[model samples]
Target: MYLLKRRVLQFFTMILLGMLLLVLLYSIDGLIPFLIVIAIAAPLIVGWQILFDQVQPQAKLAWLLAVLFIPFLGALAWVMFGRTPRRHRRVKRTSSEIRMFRQAIEMERIETANAVSDRFPLTRTLQKLGATGADGHTSTKLLVNGEAKFEAVLRDIEQATHHIHVQYYLFRTDDISSKIRDALIKKSNENVTVRFLYDGLGSQEIGEDFIEPLRESRVHVEAFDPVVHPLLVFNANFRNHQKLIVIDGKIAYTGGLNVGDEYLGKEEKLGFWRDTHLRVEGPLVRELQRLFIENWLYAGIEDDKETWDLFANEEHLPEYFIDEPKDSNGATQLLVTSPGKDVTIRDGLMQLMMEAKESIWITTPYLIPPPELLALLEVAGKSGIDVRIVVPGKGDEWFSFHATEYYFEQLLKRNVRIYKYNRHFIHAKTVLIDGKIALVGTANLDFRSMYLNHEMTIAQFETSSVQELHDAFLKDFDESILIDWSILRKKTNGKRFVEAFCHIFSPLL
Candidate 1:
């Protein structure tokens, strides 16, 4: 196959480059300096492996052997293979704060649950999902696309009374983004607290000068995991992909919609972007508000009493769910996972897939799942449960698109029905199991999202929500092209090989 040949060629090329560089260094006549550099680098590489071995044993073995055999070449290999500490540090901070915040909310949830259990008789799954208690005052609205979601966002901002907290993966400086920026500025001038958080890497296309006007208006603006520093540039691999907006701690919006021309379908190249977002009102908004506060604090912004008061509930009772270290409620578990964290969201997803009984429905833009996850899906399909996945027919990233196709041959053989959206790019990340539970969030079923990015997903236990998700899945199915195994088999060998080569670097991609 061409992909296999490419990997073989790439492997040899790397070897040749490494040997040439080493030979050149050896000829420099300054053997002592070269040896000294190796001496310093070897231990650092070893130490990093030792730390990683505790969590990722496979990575540790790969790195440790490389460093032990060729100290100089191994050092380079280690940098490529090793986990990034800068990202690890941010993960540590965020995870710790989220755990603490979840603990603080436990008691309130228990009280709310006890009161609501008599009425709703919360399902075991819902109880496990930490949704045992229900708050009557809260409302939820599902927005189908970016246009609807952004329109709602504008409406919410216009009505902002005390504070507005907005965070997104991509916040462009285009017309749509400008409209929201203008609203934030107007609110700031009206003495309303306004803060905006955008991913540094995701918003790289937009210049800082574009945001200067909002800054001049006294609206707090910060970039999450900025790559401005030389040493931190590699940290760009791990991004804050969560799109959240909290208004006065009473309303919130979250989902796949990012502030960009592509998302709004304003970009001529990519027309009519399809996505999903949810506008949440009631007690759940408090949790969303707390999430924003954690990010705000991470950005070195202070949370004042006035801002804290917005989170304090005096009228509407909120049912809170605490994220326990161990899975307590079988019905639903709030799994928050990040790199260097104990329970990863990807691991949770894997567990969910493995546990599937009757059916599994998934929607994601990218579909570069790990080997283990791919195996799980194949095994699940073999067991006769209806397994289906919806992915974008056309994507923003061509490499990722080709990479996703590499698995189709294997998946089709196992009887998994893969659907490609024909209308537009499907950016929604959601999974539904047996029409009983669903996960909705920014995380995609890709390696970057699973192992590298800081992602968020909400596990929904409510049957109504699960049904809604299922209905949406069915509707999307109607709009998608069912990929046939025969079709994949008929692809040109060159194209197939290209897909396979792209698949090879999927772990790093």
Candidate 2:
């Protein structure tokens, strides 16, 4: 209903704007020639660009259709959303910083090369896509829900001796967010350096009341691609969806849970938030710290002195770089993906699916998988590998949920099992393969995560974390209702039509 209303409003607004454009053109003398030229040239130029663009076929087709049918508005929309802006300066600076850590990373790679290659075959491919390979001697604890993750994170923040780095897609003004803010303020008073970053669009509701306190305490804060800043205006499609926190360059956390009351199951509309987060210690923490600092730099922090201060000094680099404990057998790699960059997370997921021997189990809130990934899932299921997906029984977004439903028939035909979490919104994004390797991250199994937003995933191989995720999936299965094709066929024709309509917008969704 909400989506329908929004679309109707948009349609009427576009119609009014088009009418006004015509009125203005007619009021001017000899403007018909200019209008004719625009009508002829706009679609052709945009269509040519769409054809040659790097977007997926589905998205390209969607754009082409929009241009052909709704020429003026579609061309304007294309100019705003379709063009992928290059981050050349940000990438160059980030690459240089990453290079400074390579000497230490290369030394460790020499020691763990055999273990990484033998255990995780996808690590090398991920490395080529600009992600660091597996880091051995890392200890991991699977945080089962928002409660556990917050407890661990708060405790870590309190114990921070050096500095605390934090970022979230959504930072709400609620009990949990307040607690975190107060903790960080106390730490800042104790002389701990605190840097906080949040997505401007995702946390747009965070007003001055929530941020003024932090600013007063001297905690460095910035918004990633602020929605209404002079440098950027309403960048709705491209988002920084990374949820990360690193403490003292030793411990780090990342996963599906953002800093919000809804994430804590306090949002009554979506009860019992089922999510997954990972707490890690060892070399992986350094990688996470590197990512956070690089993102901090990209978030408009340009002062060379300020950036160098965050890394401490060259003499103390070994403490942040070479410190290893050999605490667990987990070999973990962090994979990041952004628009105009290789889809590291998607490619890594496909590789894992192809290598699956026994089962491929996935849980995500959104299920609009890319065409290639959808095909891979079908193939894996047809090959007799156990393929199961768990999605939300109650989604917060209307169009995305219906768009997910549209893919059910195709997957059902391939023998893949689908389960809707009946008890709560299952927001965890995970993939467990062969009961050995697992991926836990903020990236959903959808086109946006693959091609539009910035995303990160933790690929763990030969770890107890995989078994923990396997057990969690089993528990989730017990709480979910298995979906069947026969049941889907019983839906009303109106419902089916709505789903089909929603699916048409999946590329944009």
The regions of model 2 sitting more than 4 angstroms off are 1-44, 88-111, 119-122, 125-130, 229-234, 301-305, 315-322
Highest TM-score among the candidates is held by which one? 2
* Candidate 1 TM-score versus the reference: 0.78
TM-scores for all candidates: the values are 0.78, 0.90
lDDT of 2 by residue, 1-509 (tens): 11234344455655676687688678976887888688779888988998998888888888999888999778656765566545534566656655654543444331347777777666776677666767777878899998999999999999998788899988989999999999999999898889989987777767888889998998888888776631233355677899999888789899999987888899998989999999988877777877786677677545544453346355655544546665777688888888776688888888889889999999998899888999999999999999999999998888889999888888989999999999869899999999999999999999889888889999888788988998999999999999996789799999999999989878877
lDDT for each of the candidates? 0.68, 0.81
Error of 1 at 354 (Å): 4.7
- Candidate RMSDs in order: 6.7, 3.3
Query: For model 2, what is the C-alpha lDDT against the true structure?
Result: 0.81
